[model samples]
Target: MSLILSRLKCPWCETPVTKAELKEKNLLQVYLKRQAFPCPHCNQSITLPERAEKMISSGLFVSVFLAPVFAYGGWLSINPALLFSLGVALVLTGVYFQKLQKVTASHE
Candidate 1:
């Protein structure tokens, strides 16, 4: 997956946002912060949804579960099947998050 598709975009202008920009505005500090950041392109204040934040948190948890399995497999030996499964899992997770982002509307 491309970085552009993974990162959150400005709701108003649809511009890709960097983590640094979000952190600078304190929007990425926490899931419950409810802080708003202005879009660099459209100047519209964007408030992230709590549901979206939760989705991301849960996604991380899911990835954590997979990480150990992959690590153990690597420790044993490189298995093509295991690697393929991991790649599929990652792609599915990315798709799931992208769908969540699209459905979760930002407060204008």
Candidate 2:
């Protein structure tokens, strides 16, 4: 009797991953290997999972909630402090989305 196996390819590079490869490496090692993945065909570098995780951290989630509040707090003359807070929030939201878009895209 023969066992059939399911294969997973690197999303960016399409490199075939074997079960043996996974068995020997820790998750962090696996993640780091992908950070600068060189596509055999295109040689494009893939984003590291940790970096992506950092982009989508809870701080960014909070920022998504906070940015608009700070941005529009004072419409006539936006308080400089409020504007600065809003700017920071906007940056966090941008980073969060940068990480999230990939996950969302995969589901669709």
Candidate 3:
């Protein structure tokens, strides 16, 4: 598992991009607008290719499909308001991780 995750690294510094380090807000801009920002590790520009886009879209699909599951899970915890919001957060996190894995300047 670590080896597979180690593949997701910064092209410049080779530092692993952790799930906690990813920015969820900019993911949509990067995927939809073909926009890019600086790398969290090396501060270099990171671009996503077609493969990355496909991966992100698929991740999003899975997230959406499983949203009800997350909502229900949250409902089990008795946080009624968390039902939909928790699901949305899960999808955004999925997208962020997909971008982290797929966005690499070397891959571009």
Candidate 4:
């Protein structure tokens, strides 16, 4: 899936942005909000693509699909802590590696 190739690269300048820089700029939360912010290199506005949003939310989908399996394991001793940990891990993975793309074209 395209999610696997997602990176913090700028769409305009094609410059690679680091995760730390994004975190420092508090842009990580912007992904979920689909907010626009200036690119560090070119100052052009950029935002997360829908693909990124879905990817960021895919954790819930994944958990749903795996629930039966986990439920079986729960019967065999899987604990809430483990399930919670897995959920957190999936969300973290989604938060990272989000591809930044130029916002939709001008209102013209």
lDDT winner: 4
User: For candidate 3, lDDT tens digit of each residue in 18-107?
Assistant: 544544534434434545656666767664434544544554444565555655676345443454455556545544454343345555
RMSD for each model, in Å, please? 6.8, 12.7, 10.7, 7.5
Ranking by TM-score: 4, 1, 3, 2
Please report how far candidate 1 places residue 81 from its true position, in Å: 14
Per-residue alpha-carbon lDDT of candidate 4 for residues 2-83, written as tens digits (9 for 90 to 100): 2434456788999986656767877656644667877766878887666544655676654655555667676657665566
**How well does each candidate superpose onto the true structure, as a TM-score?**
0.43, 0.26, 0.34, 0.48
Give all candidates' CA lDDT scores: 0.53, 0.43, 0.49, 0.65
What tens-digit string does per-residue lDDT give for candidate 1 at 1-108?
A: 122236667766678777677567665654135555565456566655554345444544445655556666665575645655555565556545552122224332
Please state the error at residue 8 of candidate 1 in Å: 1.4
Question: 80 in model 3: Cα distance from truth in Å?
Answer: 43
Q: Which residue pairs in model 4 clash with each other?
A: none
Residues 1-108 of candidate 2: C-alpha lDDT, one tens digit per residue: 111123435555567544455445433343344434333334343333444334344444445554456556755665646555555665565454342112223332
* Consecutive 10-residue window with the lowest summed lDDT within model 2: 99-108
lDDT of 4 at 78: 69
